[model samples]
Target: MSEIQKALVVHAEEAERIGLPHGGGFRLLADGRDTGGALGANRLSLGEGAAGARPHFHALSTELFHVLDGVVRFTLDGVTSIVAAGGLVSVPPGTPHSFGAAPGSAAELLVVLTPGVDRFGYFRALGRIQHGLGTFDDLLPASEQDRYDVHFV
Candidate 1:
């Protein structure tokens, strides 16, 4: 069967927002369906010391980050740097990378994943764990490899 395509629109108030465990909020802008698996986007707001994803890589997708406010500390291939507001960075598929809000400052950014992965469940599970509704181990089942394709490096 062929898939149908349609434009997706999301206003500020329409974003699906999720609070992170440590200190951050994520607003999902577009999912794989909306972009026809081409890309997905989320707006992230993190306080100082907020924990971001661990060092990992997407085997089949590129991750891009655009700093909208404050600074973010990004560790890419063992090198770390503070990306100030308005700065942009892109991690090619298979690159080892991690990121978080700067130690003494907060940050806001727009994160995009190209060749999108179906990660809404991952995002929701993260919020549930942060809110004490689920355990960290519950975030990733043995079948997660098939579901999200996340590779920890």
Candidate 2:
């Protein structure tokens, strides 16, 4: 860990864990504020056939993914590729992209966004919706896209 990491690392128990079915949930490891806007990161564990991110673009941030287990299917721009454990992929700002666990496979991936945007609220809403505690309506208005940092394409 770098000096910055030593100061900012989010310990496992300290991390915010979001629940989901079949072990597909998110663990927020770090957010923009924690890293002083250097980056945002989280661990995503997905089950077979679990839906992942929809096509979206970060107008001002780059997104990265590192598969740690199983296979993940990433659709970058107009192409799709299956990345297995140990694979890494990075998408620059403005690139339309999406990702999910490959059909019939389970996966875990580390996701990071550079010059990070605070997306904890957005992700929390996702957990709520998935578990029936809330509706998609809870996310926010499209007009507030800049606030949440996700612009579905």
Candidate 3:
């Protein structure tokens, strides 16, 4: 099938290969193939008291985020910045960064990972660990977090 056909035929049911983790308090909205090319777009909606992804670096990729609603507090290279509605932020490759919505408010944001990194696999692994629905410890070892270049403070 053509790429467009592939995309259009994708239903929410077939997209069940992954889901957000328990602690994440967010629902993920894209699969690895959604990007179609170098650009991959995903979204995370934060609930009250919810934080975003773990601090991570993409040695071979870059990312951009556009805050659609609510307040988001994000960190870049240890520096904290708040992104409110209609705000945009960009992070270059190899930069350590993470984001979270302010307490008691809902936040909506679009996250685009360029050159798409291994995000699909990372999130799938996270869901496995968080939900206990499956086992995938062999895929993502805690000791080799740096191998993925993801770190937490």
Candidate 4:
């Protein structure tokens, strides 16, 4: 007899929230291990003018973002675009990208990474850096960044 895999569910109120220094935050829904390495998911809330992420790329994962509220500005390669609520953007592996809440606009987003890389720790470290508990240099090592699949350009 085959064993049945249980479903994974995270209620909004129960999600782990990681607060950023600039009024932005991340609500962690699922990590790669929880999904058997299939995907990782999270919700990001950014206050007006909040920086989301600096230029980076995943060498092995594709990232998807769904704008749930307000507007977001995304830079792919060297082109920048404004994505309003309800917009979706898919970034393939190796594509350099960055994002932030559009100037003067707060934003909410659902973010997913496929072929999941365990990235919750990466997010946590980022939060710590933002809060002055850690330094960006901590994540600057190639081995450290590779562990989370984020390669800064």
Name the weakest run of 10 consecutive residues (lDDT summed) in model 4.
1-10
The alpha-carbon root-mean-square deviation between model 4 and the true structure, to one decimal in Å, is: 1.7
* Per-model C-alpha RMSD: 1.7, 3.2, 4.7, 1.7
Best by lDDT: 4
Local accuracy by lDDT, each model: 0.85, 0.87, 0.66, 0.94
Residue runs of model 3 more than 4 Å from their true location after superposition:
1-36, 132-153
TM-score of 2: 0.91
In model 2, the runs with Cα more than 4 Å from the true position are 1-6
lDDT of 1 by residue, 23-141 (tens): 68889898877889989889988888787788888888899999999989999989998899999999998889999998888899999999887787778887887798987777456
Per residue, candidate 2 scores C-alpha lDDT tens digits across 67-94 of: 9999999999989999999999999989
Q: Give candidate 4 regions above 4 Å deviation.
A: 1-5
Model 3 lDDT at residue 26: 29
Sort every candidate by lDDT, greatest first. Answer: 4, 2, 1, 3
- Cα lDDT tens digits, model 4, 1-153, are 754546899999999999987787999999988887889999999999898999999999999999999999999998999999999999999999999999999999999999887899998998899889999999999999899999999
TM-score of each model, paired residue for residue: 0.91, 0.91, 0.69, 0.95
TM-score of 1: 0.91
Better of 2 and 3 by lDDT: 2
lDDT of 3 by residue, 10-88 (tens): 3445544444443333244553456564555556667765767767766656788998888898899999998899999
Query: How much is the lDDT of residue 126 in candidate 3?
Result: 63
